[model samples]
Target: MALAKLKEAIGKEGFFLELDLADLKSVKQAAEEFLVTWEKLGEFTSYTCQWCHDSPLDQFTVQGYDLQFGTNTLGRYYFTMLLLPALQRTTGTNMTGKKARVINGSSIGHIDAPIEIPWNVLKAGSEDSKLKG
Candidate 1:
């Protein structure tokens, strides 16, 4: 499988995490697992998060937000904030001879979204509003 190839490619240098961003519970569990696993590694150095949610809207999150916004925006924000302490720990220890870094990826199409977010629709999980790239 692709995961086996990735494990072979990284060898002993890194590991992969499996998480579902649309589900808050999954995100939280993944973060907890990462913390536990990395703590056993004895040091942390850097973290990279690459999340992209751009598909036809077909579901709503448990929190009543559109799937794309919930997963790509809110969920990613929550996950990153949760990991800050672990990232800070790495800097405190000078583990990699540098400060811990975080890299976030965004799509250029984001600029096309309306300046005023449809908060009401998002909060109410209303499908009346269509999302455009």
Candidate 2:
């Protein structure tokens, strides 16, 4: 659905790889699939995790890590590492001959994030979870 929208707006067919940032396995597969299709990465954009859980319960991703940490930290790190080679190939692959740069995007909401990681929150049903500011 998102690819269709992009195609309609750009008037050109594009590549799309299904990604679930919450799962490490999904991130690895997405990176692999993307590298298989594209030899070089001209531009790659990675954004911060935006999932917000308000159910009064600690949520865990399929990999058994905190949903947000798994998606925001683990998932992004793994995906970027796997794509490093493709990114490196950008030096002479693009018209501008520029190397690909990884961008860590964030929103204003980050200002309210805890200064330090609360270890207990990383596990599901860890009622002791408390975000330290």
Candidate 3:
């Protein structure tokens, strides 16, 4: 719907991109497509996200990461790191006269009650853990 609205406003000048940041495969695909197009155009870009995904309010996982934390912070961090090379190349001031900007659109939720990481839970590990083997 957001994509549709943006397309309606921008018409042929707009392209739609869908990325499910919860999944690494999707992130890789987005990074590859972005690099190919941006490098071709010799244009620079910035990225932003308002971390909004959430789990049911009452539940907690043993591994200890909240759904919003995974979606907002971890996913944003991974995507930025993955695309840094392309972003840097395109936005380098020597070429485009612009430095790449990364806007992590955070909210009062994170600011007001930041998670006190349970390093123990983080280390305990779970099969569903998105981090890695």
Candidate 4:
């Protein structure tokens, strides 16, 4: 449906990609492919991303890191880091030129529950009650 609508809307050829954001390897591969294609064509406009990792798992692990920190924050951070160069190239600017905005999909939950916890809770291996914030 989206493809048909896009074709109708554009009245020309359009490319669409499907991806799973939960997988780091997939994200990395997609970034690489985008770079290679952009390099070959020598034309790229901009890179945009909307990051949201609000799914709370009982316990999830990737590369031996906790899901909350790994998925909600760190993964997005690293993915942005890896793709910075390509994004810069896309916009025809160096790293220091324009600020590459990373719009985090932060929830009101953070503000709603303002009770501060110790930093160690974030670092501690145990996902205890105190760390549930």
**CA RMSD of each candidate after superposition:** 4.6, 3.2, 6.5, 6.1
Among all candidates shown, the one with the greatest lDDT: 2
For model 2, name the residue pairs that clash: none
Q: On a 0 to 100 scale, what is the lDDT of residue 48 in model 2? A: 75
Question: Across residues 57-127, which tens digit of lDDT does each residue of candidate 1 receive?
Answer: 54667776777678778778778877877878777456456667677776665666668966765654455
Give the alpha-carbon lDDT of every model: 0.66, 0.77, 0.55, 0.51
lDDT of 4 by residue, 1-133 (tens): 8778888998976665443344577667766765666542223333323223443424443454445555655556666666677655545354445543445555444553337743443433555513443
How do the residues 1-133 of candidate 3 rate in per-residue lDDT, one tens digit apiece? 7768877887845566566665556767887887777653333243434344443432232324444545565656777787788657666554647666665555556554546853333222344443432
TM-score of each: 0.72, 0.80, 0.60, 0.54
Q: Of the candidates numbered 1 and 4, which has the greater TM-score value?
A: 1
lDDT of 2 by residue, 32-132 (tens): 89888888887778887555534223566797777777777888888999999899988676887667788878666556767887787787656665453
What is the lDDT, from 0 to 100, of the residue 27 in candidate 1?
80
Arranged by TM-score with the best first, the candidates are 2, 1, 3, 4
RMSD of 1: 4.6
Model 3: which residue pairs collide?
A: none
Candidate 1 local accuracy as lDDT?
0.66
Give the better candidate number (1 or 2) by lDDT: 2
